[model samples]
Target: MVEKHTPSFIRKGSGKKKADTTEQFEKAVSRLAEGKYVLRLYVAGMTPNSARAIANLKKICEEHLAGRYDLNVIDVYRKPTLAKGEQIIAAPTLIKKLPLPMRKLIGDMSDEGKVLIGLDIRTR
Candidate 1:
């Protein structure tokens, strides 16, 4: 199951609020301890390569990551600003942003082994 925590705001001049905030923060930290995966897939357009990459990525995430992952698919054709922000120099790029030691994999994601390894889904 996916873990979701609502941030508790601390009120001023209340010792109880401070303790509650600390407790909430610890709970949030504990929830993340299971290792949540944040992924971004950048595609140029609705080309064959882009479609394939999206399909492959979805399959991999369903099989390997399931509820533990958040996949954000960004189309450079539609939103060039997002592409520029990430400094993407190629189409069909996958960026793994969580679980520490961020990684980027470039391709249509045809090679499942390479994609899995690149995303730290599997040990090399």
Candidate 2:
């Protein structure tokens, strides 16, 4: 029987691996980049609705984008300036700033499936 051997062209630094095009590299960068999802949860005071919204958003972020997101819980009542900057008109508004196509969800955010789908965090 003939002995099998590795091809000469398969040596190290042979450039056989696919080169990362701009788009491919960008996509990879976006995927691998940690803390890419910047979420700001705007709430009002310590009302039950606000508390519920915070809890739901926190759970969703931890479950879906754990270690890949930065969640800033902003109590608009405590810090009204933050609202002016983000133009938050309603309580318990979640804003996804990064990962492109910014989205806003206004509610208690108790709807897991809806929240996931809205923020593009739902996996197929």
Candidate 3:
């Protein structure tokens, strides 16, 4: 006669532990879905490109992120040290600082699709 071995997780009285773990994982996912976004926009100066980037970013944030985002606009011309710290080699760069896996988008931010993808915003 062959004896069948049951997995440890399938042992008796393990249902409670499995249920607890599942609940915890669900809570974590919920928190992440509702987490706030932190972003920074680094620009050279108040030039045309910078202006466009700022406007575009603000619009995008208001439309998608709404009140769940914190945006900081930095003038590299005035705050050279800050720019150097972030290793910014180009103007009109948007950095997503929160929600892990930081991302950088460089341009006038006119491409809404690309910006949305970079920011990990869901589009319906």
Candidate 4:
């Protein structure tokens, strides 16, 4: 295993909002040096694609993030309101809501490289 340096994570109920401005966004990304990740996955029921996404994401998280991330799986079919709130147009979308500069990835998460890049796990 690579030597892991555990970063400090924002505690639950930290009430942090997504950064909007470029400066704020930069700050958010910089905070990743010392902050944990917060992730939310939106899916439509237990469809095949959704299931695959969940599984792929779990595997990636276990490998890269391990104890340093929060993963929330939301069934949009059951929570239309939440979907609407996030303006989610596609199913099986993963949203990284914390560690500054929120990010989103839309797919089944089958491509580990793409998912890792999208989630800022691997650069270049």
Candidate 5:
């Protein structure tokens, strides 16, 4: 049996490789620029509540805001000062930083519809 040749991948410890091609990336970016949103999620620690929030946020991001959101999950436990600066009185709070007005949603973020509405993500 003849062996097939495969391209070798070098160990680039930088990070993940892009899943999309240039065209796809451009399309995603264009979609993002059109009514896209920037999100900052504050978590207190690695507790169950924090984990739930992260999972739910990811769910919303993937299902509704796929290519249209920039999610930043900041752990207050790691940086309590940041939390103080942001004046976060609650754990697992999602702050919509972009697309204006800056609305905040505090909870586990388990409700997809609520998350979508909060993030201004209109689905088809």
Candidate 6:
């Protein structure tokens, strides 16, 4: 007679683990869908790029985030200390502070798709 052994993950009770993982994923998605977003944009004065970034971000927020977001625009020229605290190395930097797992996007924010993805906004 030959002895056989099954891997721990392949055992019968392992199905419970899979179920738990699926439940956790669903809960996470639900939280993200209902969570409020906190955002901060660091800009260098009212330069063209900074202005564009602000405009683009506002448009996206109104379209997607709507009443679920808080946006703060900071001019580095007027608030260098705030910029340094956030470690902003560029003129136009957008930081997504809430909804967990902070994300940063740099540039004029002209690309809607990229900005949406960066802000974790799911497209309908």
Candidate 1 lDDT over 1-124, as tens digits, reads 3221111111111112335878856654664686777677777767888888877887788888888875667667766776777788899888876766778889999999999899877889
Model 4 stretches astray by more than 4 angstroms: 1-34
Which residue pairs of candidate 5 clash?
Answer: none
lDDT of 6 by residue, 1-124 (tens): 0011112112222122335878866755675687867677777876889778877887788788777775677667766676778899997998887777899999999999999888888644
Q: Which residue pairs overlap in candidate 6's backbone?
A: none
The deviation in Å at residue 15 for candidate 6 is 51
Flag regions of model 2 displaced more than 4 Å: 1-32
Q: Output the better candidate (3/5) by lDDT.
A: 3
Q: What is every candidate's alpha-carbon RMSD to the true fold?
A: 10.2, 17.3, 19.1, 7.2, 11.0, 19.1
lDDT of 5 at 13: 15
lDDT tens per residue, model 5, 76-123: 666677677777899888888777667899999987788777777754
Can you write out model 4's per-residue Cα lDDT over 44-114, one digit (the tens) per residue? 87788887887788889889987877676777766677778888999888889886567889999999999
- Positional deviation of 96 in candidate 5, in angstroms? 0.7
Query: Pairs clashing in candidate 4?
Result: none
Report the error of model 5 at residue 21, Å: 33
TM-score of each: 0.72, 0.67, 0.70, 0.72, 0.67, 0.70
Model 4 per-residue lDDT at 90: 92
TM-score for candidate 1, please give it. Answer: 0.72
What lDDT tens digits, residue by residue, belong to model 3 across residues 19-89?
A: 58788567545645879676778888778888888778888988887777756777777667767788899
**lDDT score, candidate 3, position 33:** 88
Residue 116 C-alpha lDDT in model 5: 78
Q: Name model 6 segments beyond 4 Å from true.
A: 1-34
Provide the global lDDT of candidate 4 against the true structure. Answer: 0.73
Pairs of residues at least 3 apart in sequence or in different chains that clash in candidate 2: none
> Which one wins on lDDT?
4
